[model samples]
Target chain A: MEEEAETESITLQDSAAGGRIDGKWGYIWGAYSVTWVLLVGYTLSLVLRGRLLRRSSGVER
Target chain B: MKLPFAWEHLIGVIALLLFCYGQVFGLFMVPPDAHMGDVARILFVHVPSAWNAFFVFTIAFVCALGYLISGRKGFDHALEAALEVGILLTILLLMTGSIFAKPTWDVWWKWEPRLTSSAIMLMTYVGVVVLRSVVQDNERRAVWSSAATILASVTLPLTYFSVQIWRSIHQIQTSPADIDAPLRMAWRINALAVLLLATWFLARRWRIAARRWELGDAPPLPEPLQPEEV
Candidate 1:
């Protein structure tokens, strides 16, 4: 019981000092992953659409 | 024969390199925020996306005005491209902002002034795009869409200033003094990277629009039925 109380106090102190919720790295990584996925996917779609349009129109760069 | 180089290609390469560098610097080198900790890294992407959305919308606004004044098809095409790219970036901004808010604000969404105004601005432009698709006449579509684009752009400034104009939980725009040096550096680099990438996308989108304008929107007609079959 004494050791449990000590650990709880340390956790409270850490939270107070940092002003951060512990174990929020998942949110951080999730945000970054979603961002990259959207960016890459959108870019690919743009490129493929452009290519298809060029082919259909018989336009050459 | 290929010239072996183009300005757009060069910009794409440079933007890619700068983006990689900025992401590396931001994700690995910059220290976490005192309050938000690692979650603050989301700002590197979120802020740049917001800025690019604003930048593209501004371009669209100018193009719309130009089309109105000169009646130029080029301006209309440019407006179309910018509106598309701007909407895409705005969607990205909202998604990233929501993701950041989840941990920081303990909510996935909010109807605060800034957030609400951004959603309105996004939907307004989206409506403009949809308006264009449903209108069949080229000249009529151009005129109507340009008008809508200009009217929708009024919301851009509102969205930018929403945090200041209303009581809100969202943080106000930060000044240079408020940011740490390394984080500011990362932010600036990422901002430029997004700007360049946006330029590339705008150019490509514009080309596609111009090509479509030239080719016309009519579907290819089916070959006449065979005489024997008829």
Candidate 2:
């Protein structure tokens, strides 16, 4: 039973290493890039709209 | 014309810097998950975005109730701003979740209970925004949107607990006790950063809505540029 458990652990580690070798970095990068773009873009849109509204209302801050 | 720096500007700058710091720490300093490998880093942003989405929805729900009770236009403006930010955060949550799913679940999308409920919530709020636009009278718009917001918020709690309540491929919600110390730290930091950023955005949006409300229906248009003098 102990030997069997050892082999199973080894197999798990091997598969994990294989996943790293396969390089799924693209997925990670994609997720981060998309998040950054969406957040920054939305914030910029809000800022611009605020400026436009202020200009239109002629409310000098 | 250069605008003077204000407290909101300071808050915005601090929020941006803190978020960047959190991202760097999360991506590089925290150890990768044994099962998920480096891809687990996505949790830094994804979880926080989901939390903020829920938070903003709760704000919208409260504002909706406030409007009903007080009949104040300010509450309506606050409701609309919160709803708008909540929608944006929900979209971010969905997109990030999809991206994370592709690697971890080996599928880009799934029609599981959590995903389905979240999508429904997103659509319901989106419908509220559209409903507000379609209605012409201010009182009618406020009444309709406030009612819709309250109705839509029912899905928020459902979506939050879907994974636990139903059979779902999505992982159960993580708590500080469940995560490693370093990961917990990074997650908490990022959560705070996102919350600050959301607060800044919410403040600006609420102010803009209030200003428009004050301006009434006919806001003056910009004057056309005159021809240069010969």
Whole-model lDDT values for every prediction: 0.85, 0.84
Q: Whose lDDT is greatest here?
A: 1
Residue range B106-224, candidate 1, lDDT tens digits? 78898989999999999999999999999877788899999999899999999999987884677668788978999899899999998998888888888888877776764323245
lDDT of 1 at B126: 97
Q: List candidate 2 segments past 4 Å from native.
A: A1-22, A59-61, B1-5, B219-230
Top candidate on DockQ is: 2
Could you give the DockQ of candidate 1? 0.23
TM-score of each: 0.87, 0.86
Show where candidate 1 strays beyond 4 Å. A1-18, A59-61, B1-5, B220-230
| lDDT, candidate 2, at B110 | 89
Q: Give the lDDT of residue B181 in candidate 2.
A: 96
C-alpha DockQ for predicted model 2:
0.31
lDDT of 1 by residue, A1-61 (tens): 7975575456444433536655577877887788788878878988887777777676322
RMSD of 2: 5.7
Model 2 steric clash pairs: none
| Model 1 CA lDDT for position A12 | 40
